[model samples]
Target: MTNFEEDISVYNFVSILGECFQNKASVNLVKHYPTGRMLAVKRFHLDKIWDNISIVQQEITLTKQLQHPNIITYYTSFVHGPEVFAVSPLQAFGSCKSLLDSHFNEGLPELAIILIFKDIIEAVNYLHKSGFIHRAIRASHILISASGKASLSGLHYACPLVINGRWQRAVHSFPLSTQPNLNWLSPELLEQNLKGYNEKSDIYSLGILCCELANGREPFADVDSTLMLVEKVRGCIPGLLDCTTLPSKCDDRECQGDCDIEISLSRRGFSQYLHEFCYMCLEREAKDRPSAAELLTHPVFTLVNKGISLPELLKPVLPLSDKVSPNKEMCHLDHVLHMSEMDMPSCDWDFPIS
Candidate 1:
């Protein structure tokens, strides 16, 4: 607080480079005029801040307590007038959702997903050990650091299970504005029943995250919310799409395509281990899902190429340092890179991949 150089405020940082999707519209990208350093400053709306002040304070307190390499920590936060500014480092690649929008529309490579998920699961494991549940764990909440580290953020919805110094069975409260995360939420959380839900709910969301990363689209994209909810409760599970799961192109109605089911490992798209992992994650009963720590031991993670770095797997996608400027125009021009558009099955979540 003594030196102005260490301080970040509206006066020192100038202009909004881009809007941050982490907390919807509350965070903005600001650049320091002299050093040309960019950072995100989170500012809640004055009118809405009063209504959600408890949640805001809870997020700040939780961030200070939850320290992990994979979790996002703030540089400093101070109140200026009616707004509170929480400044943090600018992730070079932005949120994974941005990546899906600019590049990698057909999902990221398997190695890249492994690298990112490993970091995210580590964070989730830490939170679970600390008796907290990160209600939001979707791709949109994940950011790729300049050094290829994945950071789990958007902690406003995170809540603690330890109340009155006692570990509770489950939490009955629902997350605010649940619509955006409806597709990824566990059935119990959506059901809001007296039985309640526990940290296992987050594991279910994590499973949906895998499917999202692998398939390059939401698990229940464009489906009716009411119908999706009903199906999810009735044991409808989404999966990582690949040749192993999808029916053969040559569909003989009479034969029912059952005879050609046995395919070589080389011809199959994703490995059997991945399918099994997803199956465990998407188990209809919350108790059936594996814990974050348990999931880390799965063989699918063994496929991670330890030899190659995450940045290498993300070829042709330049980090901010590689770019000339933060200008949206310069960053979005897709002239040099060529991406393969995945011809994913256009059916709904009910698509019979068998």
Candidate 2:
């Protein structure tokens, strides 16, 4: 039997769901015959794993160690020849990216953004406490389960800040195979300097995510990446768009996507609390960024209604629980411009001899 057949026969896997993250992996819907429970099986084609098979091994190992409600639940895994399968709860609503593509093309309502990011930030806090840097955090990496819970996925790029019982102040190397996530990456990480970067890098990325959900597109996404990098290194900040921030017109589309705007000055029709929160996350200096724990208490998040329900917020677009079917048609990878095409600027850094 082929690896997939062997997997289906052994684990009762069924219904090939769809692909995600540039088609590098595919998600399968499986029903556990013993309990008749449903699960999401992520199959990784080892050949497509950028860094040998070790990274997939690292992902599985790290996922097993995590046990937060807002984090994806990893059940088990098995290596069938060159393919590795990771089983988890099926997120019927799919990824936040898919939601953006299907329902909220004009960007999610601010309240919805709050509810979603609340879960994401809490998940980040958990990882930070565990001494792990989630090097790749973005909209697409967040999946919404049948309960309307947003769980943080994409631990494949995560790494430890604690090395050999010592807490390392900085991580000199960037996570490999994160080319598609460059826009969401922190500037300090892109700088690739000797000083290296720390957990604050995640904060910067979080700020970018705030702008992404608020504006319906990633901040600075319309421009060439090299220019965006230069802009970021030079301290240009992206912010929330509104009637005030957007230019009168971009011919047909609104004039958007320049990273140079100041976040603090924006009165962009959005709540001031949220505006300040984004500003705090996008601080030019990494040290100026707040920790994940600190951000959880921000008034922007505190303002959310006590009775907030993601399922209630997302009514017309209900979960895919009614039936299992292919979702690749709406996975939203088309607009994800790959950074591998961009020429990377030279950086000076010392390579630690292993």
Candidate 3:
């Protein structure tokens, strides 16, 4: 039998109610025969033994460290033979990817898109505050819960903060044969210099996700992979193509240079606030890009809030019962908060690596 068939057989007696979603990394669904209530099962393929060890270890470690409602809860992890399995709260509505696919032919509701973005940003901020960086932040990683709440999943790419006071770069390099989602990569990552990627890269990816939401289609859908990479490296900006009620310019530029204002004016339009948020995220300069925490306070995000502070906005709606022990949470939170508050007493926000 195939790996999937073998894995399904083990959980087969549990009776899968339905297939909720499937992605490059996981298949999510609710099961019934094992119990009367709903449950989320994430089945990981162990046949590809190349990176399974590290991915599995990171998933368990990251899940244990994170505690937020916007993050999908990790109930338990089990090793059944060669396959690794994890159980969490199942979201009946599936993922943002599924929703976007269904509505691509038409269009997603602006409010729904805003709400989803808010949840994603809040989740990322929480992760950053907790001293973890989710290297992979995409539509498929977001789960729309049964109650319509968006939660982030897929911690396999997450990495803990290196305590050596060095800014470690991402080690997960994409192969040349596999075309990367250039629309989601920051210019720094796409550049030939091979400059290391950091949290700012995640922000760039988030900007692409926003574009997808606004246009109701994948960013650079028609562009071939090679041309997409070239444009990305050359700083080709993407604009909304679906809605005509917004503005033409993607964002305000202090200097228009030689570019024709008329051409800029003819581009697709989007909500001014949303466009600004996307532009800030897509900024070529990493330092200019807002941190996830700062983005939570931006006008685009704050405009949708009733009266929530950044910390409050970072809090998840779900209870922390599914999280690791309170003591562990406190330790992790304390360390992260302390690190965040640390200011270089001598170097003006710069730390010397030695």
When sorted by lDDT, best at the front, the candidate numbers are 2, 1, 3
How do the residues 189-283 of candidate 1 rate in per-residue lDDT, one tens digit apiece?
A: 98899999999999999889988887677788878999999989898998886666665454465764433432221134766777787789889
Question: What TM-score fits each model?
Answer: 0.81, 0.82, 0.67
Which lDDT value does model 3 have at 178? Answer: 20
What is the overall TM-score of model 3 with all chains considered together? 0.67
**By TM-score, who's the top model here?**
2
Scored by lDDT, the top model is: 2
In model 1, the clashing pairs are none
Between candidates 2 and 3, the one scoring higher on TM-score is: 2
Model 3: residue 279 alpha-carbon error in angstroms: 1.5
Tell me the deviation in Å of residue 249 in model 3: 19
Minimal lDDT window, size 10, model 2:
345-354
What local distance difference test score does each model get?
0.70, 0.73, 0.56
- Report the lDDT tens digits of candidate 2 across residue range 123-179: 999999999888788777788887878888888788789999999999987777767
